[model samples]
Target: MKQFIQGIKDGGAIGIGYLSVSFTFGLAAVSSGLQWWEALLVSMMNLTSAGQFAGITIMAAAGTYIEMALSQFVINLRYALMSISLSQKVDKDFRAGRKMLLGFAVTDEIFAVAMSREGEVSSQYFAGLAVLPYLGWTGGTLAGAVCGNILPKTVTDALGLAIYGMFIAIIVPAMKKDSRILKITLLAVAFSFIVYYLPGLRNISSGFAVIICAVAASAIGAVCFPMEEEQEGA
Candidate 1:
C-alpha cells in the first residue's frame, strides 16, 4: 500500500504532462474531422502521443487500413522493446496476467520511472504508477474534445499549435545530448521533405510517406551508429 501510494505520487507529474499534451491532441483530432467522442476514444485506447498523431494524420488523409497498421507498427516499435526491458524489473511473484495488464500501461515515462527504482517493481506499485497518467490523458482528451466543439474555430486552431511545441520540447533536449540523435533527427526531416516534395515521391500517400521516412532514416541510423558494446550489454 505504501509503495502504491508512492507510485501515485511519483506519477503525478507525468499525469500533468500528459494532460497538456493530450489536450492538444484532442483539439487536433477533432479539428481534423474526428468527432469529439471519437477523439476521446482515441485517447482512451492509445497512450502514445507520436503514434496517436500519426494515426490521426493517416485517418485525416483517408489512408488505407494497411498504411495505418504499418505506420503504427513502425512508430510504436520502441514500446515492445521497453516492455521487454521492464519485464526484468518486475517482482518475482508478478504473474503473467498481471504483467500483461501492466504492460498495457507502460508508457515511456512509466517505464523510465520503474526502471530507475532501486529493486524489483511490485505489481501494485506499477499499477499505482499507471493510474494518474492514464486518467489525466483520457480526461484531458475529453476536455479538449469538448472544448473543440464549443470553442470558436480560430481559438481551437491556435491551441492546436501546442502539440508541435510539445514535440519540439521532447526532441531538442535529446538532440543536444547526442550527436547521433541530432543526425538522425536531421535525416528524418530531410526524408520527410524529400517524400513530400520530390517529383515522383510526392504522389505517395501521406501515411506511406511517414512510414518510408521513419523506417529508412531509422534503419540508416541504426546501421551507421550502432550502440556501443557497453550500452548493448546494459
Candidate 2:
C-alpha cells in the first residue's frame, strides 16, 4: 500500500505532462472527424503519443487496415523494446498475467521512472504509477475534444503544435548526450524530408512513408551503432 502511494506520487509529474500532450491529441482527433468521446476512447485504449498520433492521421486519411497495422507496428516498436528491458526490473513473482497487464501501461516516461528505481518494481507499485497518468491523458482528451470547437481556431492550432514540442523535449537531451542518437535522429529527419519532397518518392502515402523512413533509419542505426552485448542485456 505504501509502495502504491509512493508510485502515485512519483507519477504525478508524468500525469501532468500527459495532460497537455493528450489535450492536443484530443483536438487533432476531433478535428479529423472523430466524436469527442471517440477521441477520449482512443486515449483510454492507447497511452502512446506517437502511435496515437499516427493512428489518428491514418484514420483521417481513410488508410487501409494494413497501413494502420504496419504504421502502428513500426512506430510502437520501441514500446516492445522498453517492455523487454523493464521485464528485468520486476519482482521475481511478477508472473506473466500481471506482467501483461502492466505492459499495457508502460509509457516511455513510466518506463524511465521504473528503471531508475533502486530495486525491483512490485505489481502494486506499478499499478499505482499507471493510474494518474492514464486518467490525466483520458481526462485531458475529453476536455480538449469537448471544448475544441468553443475555442478560437488560432488557439487550437497553437495547441496542436504542443505535441511536436513534447517530442523535441524527449529527444534533444538524449541526442546531446549520445552522438549515436543524434546521428540516427538526423538520419530519420533526412529520410522524412526525402519522402516529403523527392520526386516519385513523394507519391508514397503518408502512413507508408512513415513506415519506410522509420524502418530504414532504425535498420541503419542498428547496423552503424550496434549496442554491445552488455548494453543489450541491460
Which pairs of residues collide in model 1? none
TM-score of each: 0.92, 0.87
Superposed by TM-score, candidate 2 places the C-alpha of residue 62 at a distance from the truth, in angstroms, of 1.4
Task: Tell me the tens digit of each residue's lDDT in model 1 across 121-165.
Answer: 998899899999999999999988887888898886786676667
> Candidate 2: RMSD over Cα atoms?
2.6
Candidate 2 — what's its lDDT?
0.86
What is the per-residue lDDT of model 2 for residues 1-234, given as tens digits with 9 covering 90 to 100?
999999999899999998988888888787666889888889999988989888888998999899999998887888889898899899987799998888899998999899888899998889889989998899988987888767787876676666566678777998888888888889988999998999999779888988888789979999998998566421
Question: Roughly what TM-score does model 2 have, to 2 decimal places?
Answer: 0.87
